[model samples]
Target: MQINQLTRVYRYDGIDLPIPPHLADDPQGLRAYHATLYPAILNAETVDAGVIGTTHVTEYRRAVGTKG
Candidate 1:
């Protein structure tokens, strides 16, 4: 059987953000870490964009709405 190493990438504002090596397997940590770099991520939704090749893709989609 062939083995494929999994990798993660976060899509933000049409750009792919690479996760730090230390937080590669830590989803929650990466979210918080990335949030620091990108405040929008704090309110953004985390969605799996599925796997492409050997990499696993995730997207930080902003929640659009007007203040009520």
Candidate 2:
């Protein structure tokens, strides 16, 4: 769960659709959906690259990095 990224499980005629990155390329639709569904799981995704022994996980939708 992450900020900006909303998790939506949509049911239409008993069919479930997954809308994970709602605000990425479609913010308007995401907003509209948010207004209606009022999502249950909402969280902000963050990454920590300052740690000494580790790996950093970041959303490409928000941050960019390169590794060699």
Candidate 3:
């Protein structure tokens, strides 16, 4: 007999969803899960409206290009 230790749980608004071992180990899977579970809230119109500033990139410089 074998037993697997449980890890990772998603809790929101009194909801408790267990994360499978395989999904917990996968980074992309975890992100996809969240995106799927809360698409409406995550994709709310307010999110786009909240971004009011623009980042102007004046130059492109690779910080790691020159190693010390």
Candidate whose TM-score is highest = 1
Query: For candidate 2, what is the TM-score?
Result: 0.23
**Please, what are the lDDT tens digits per residue for candidate 1 over residues 1-68?**
98889877788888888678998879899999989888999999999999998878899999999978
**Clash pairs for candidate 3:** none
- Better model by TM-score: candidate 1 vs candidate 2: 1
Off by over 4 Å in 1: none
Candidate 2, pairs of clashing residues: 2-43, 2-44, 2-45, 3-43, 3-44, 3-45
TM per candidate: 0.82, 0.23, 0.34
TM-score order, best first, reads: 1, 3, 2
Task: Indicate the worst ten consecutive residues by lDDT in candidate 2.
Answer: 54-63
C-alpha lDDT score of every prediction, in listed order: 0.88, 0.36, 0.41
Arranged by lDDT with the best first, the candidates are 1, 3, 2
Write candidate 2's Cα lDDT for 1-68 as tens digits.
64343333333323333455746457456535543553321222222223233322222122235645
Question: In candidate 1, how many Å is residue 43 off?
Answer: 0.2
Using lDDT as the yardstick, the better of models 2 and 3 is 3
RMSD of 1: 1.5
Error of 1 at 4 (Å): 2.3
